[model samples]
Target: KTTDILVQAQICAALNRHVIDVTTPNVGLQDWSNSAEYYQQSPCNHYAKFWDQQGISVDQLAYGFPYDDVFEYSSSVHTPSPSRVVVSFGPYTDGGGNDNDEDITGMGGNLSVQFTDSPAGEGFANLIDNDAATKYLTFNSSAWVQFQANNAYSLSSYSITSANDAPQRDPLNWNLQGSNDGVNWTALDVRSGVDFPSRQQKQTFQVAANSAFTYFRFNLTNNSGSILQLAEIELFGEGSSSGFSQTIQAENYSSMSGVQLENGAGAEADQNVGYIDTNDWMAFNSINIPNSGNYTVSYRVASEGSGGELSLDVNGGANVLGYRTVPGTGGWYNWTTVSHTIYIEAGTYNFGIFAQTGGWNLDSWTISLASGASAQSAATAFNSENSMLEIAEISLSPNPAKSQLQIDFTAEHANLTLLNAHGRLMESTSNVPSGSLLSISHLKKGLYFLQVEIDGKVTVKHFIKE
Candidate 1:
């Protein structure tokens, strides 16, 4: 399949796993493999609640993730007559509360935009309507838009999009300011002589926000023309609880010195950072280590040769965290997860991943509070497959298993049976501990079910042999 197709499949799978819909806010999952009859139950649980939001469509099908079209969950509406398509604009409001459509600030949609130093009737609501065609136009050369979140956020980065037309009206100089109180503002990021070559072009800038702030303002100092117009502004940051786990794709760096994205060969991993050289680094801004003590950082990497090492640091090496030596995984496309625990101070940082030695590809990385990380057990990791047979006690890892399938449960003595797609018994075992690795190297690549029975209670889990 093409990258687009694979990405769509991944998005559909992610949405299904999370059970995200209009009513529920993704509480927990009951199954992982099946979502055909998922909506039959009310208040379903979902995954990735931090970023994913319910769609605006009547059916609640939206593209919360990048690849959400695989199972037709995309908000993109198709029609036979493209020329006849018409989009309706909203009934504008004057700087009132806004339901965070994307949860971009991680503030649970409880945010409002306040306009300052701008003439009346500038249509401030259009600034964040997710529509580039509509704009917040003002005759004034300088303007400021303040975003107020319910909780203080350690903002890492922000983006500004140019209006649909009039290049001369684009902003040239701007300052991103943060503040606890709206009166006292401190500049976090400043840019001058900025250019927007294309219309509706979005440029993201990293903010050196060390502390969390309740209010953030975009101070547009100067513009190319007397009439300044802007399409939209977005803020990215972390909220009060930094204990939650955040997984970031290696290719999705805010900035990079020497790195490139290539097609990933691993299961569900479509892209990865490759062609890394020694001293080459990638920067991910606004990584919030809220009152951090011990945090576990895991990286999914692959290398064909040894001597490759990855070092992690914060804020241009102002604080060097640690380094991990990469072991050869036989092939450049082969992948494995490696982790390390490191202590960090309470602050927001620009996390820098440097290549101490070359010859490895990085797919992704995850950071979680070590103190709260253990709460996520295997069962919690892989939520649901069949709700009717859903057993919260048992869980499986690497669902699209290549070789060994890990079964995690606390059952003292459980009988395990593996059956192929046709329900014919293939493998059987007895008396396995909580963390047991079952070898299925001989099994063919296809759909299979693992039936686990403990104390006369039977539970079936669905997995794919990749």
Candidate 2:
């Protein structure tokens, strides 16, 4: 019986599991397994048994099976950037393989995955295992998978890979939502009529979101068939933008006009404000614009008609921020993001989104500090040196310092913060003195931004670490 089982394993490996008609080669590697009498490792570690080869070194032999590297027992090089690589197909010297390297996917940070529904064998964990050969499938079409991380990630994009079989089971529509409490969710991106044309094919879409969330939920609402299968899901990009960034759901308004809420598709709120017409508007109170100059307001909107336009204003059009033309997205739920960067003053006001042309559905809106507009330059912030409420005159010698950076300010005490280009805080010091020297030797060679907060005012400036 053992001999017959070995032959069956060998046949399964030789066929590659997909060939309909094939000719078996005369000579091939043999597959073997041992019973408890001979093997001591658990069943989970049995894959490592084949490589043992009765103490015969596999370091100089080809892999006997596809998964021979189950326990880092095969020839694989993992590096962020290899100085040089030399590969020889015939004979090569073993450089002593290093298997302790961390997985490349872990750079995005570790995530604990959970799902609302899936089969026993086909688990949600497979969706992020980085193995395209495995997949997550479910009979329930309306399934949602949530990924929680230790820190919030300002995800810029995410990808989905179709399973190896059953193209009809691919998801047709979904939403990528984010939350801090895992209960009060915010729709980050929404997609409808999604199609996976090829098997095991990956499709990446940009996340129209600015705020960061520790919890992300991939809510699959619709599919072609009654089932859904996905081989993998990969999230890309991290860190939120510097300065103020706020996203408000359109349905969560203080007041509205000429619109009604209805169930929508994708990673947005369950309800969207639709039936908009010219002169219709929604207002949000206490919308704070912190040190704002030129703020970019992005609207998540969709329309099936030809023309749709909206205007952002403060206090019932007392001050119009700007207008954006919403493009027809083929369906009312086929959401897309549109933006308008307009100058805004630093104050808390009742913000309003008024329909200028109408015929569109509003899912959500985000207002973020525009790049290079986080705050007035350090020089401008210090123009009034006598004002006690403003940051003092600041200066940094050696604009592109190699190891040390000197910060000079006139304030008796001020808070200094260092952030990478992605707005990730690297170091911070409170009540820093004038002419304070900071060590930057540990930071990589790149651009960095420094924020100086004095009294209640904040000033931003950029510097280079070389």
Clashing pairs in 1: 8-70, 18-46, 18-47, 30-384, 31-384, 31-385, 32-384, 32-385
Compared with the true structure, what per-residue lDDT tens digits does model 2 show for residues 343-390?
655678999999988899999999986544323332333332334344
lDDT string, candidate 1, 374-405, tens digits = 22222322332344554447879977566898
Instruction: For residue 32, give model 2's deviation from the true position in Å.
Output: 22
Error of 1 at 227 (Å): 1.8
Worst 10 residues of 1 by lDDT: 92-101
Per-prediction backbone clash count? 8, 2
Model 2 pairs whose backbones collide: 175-266, 175-267
lDDT of each: 0.64, 0.64
Clashes of 1: 8
Candidate 2: stretches off by over 4 Å: 1-117, 240-466
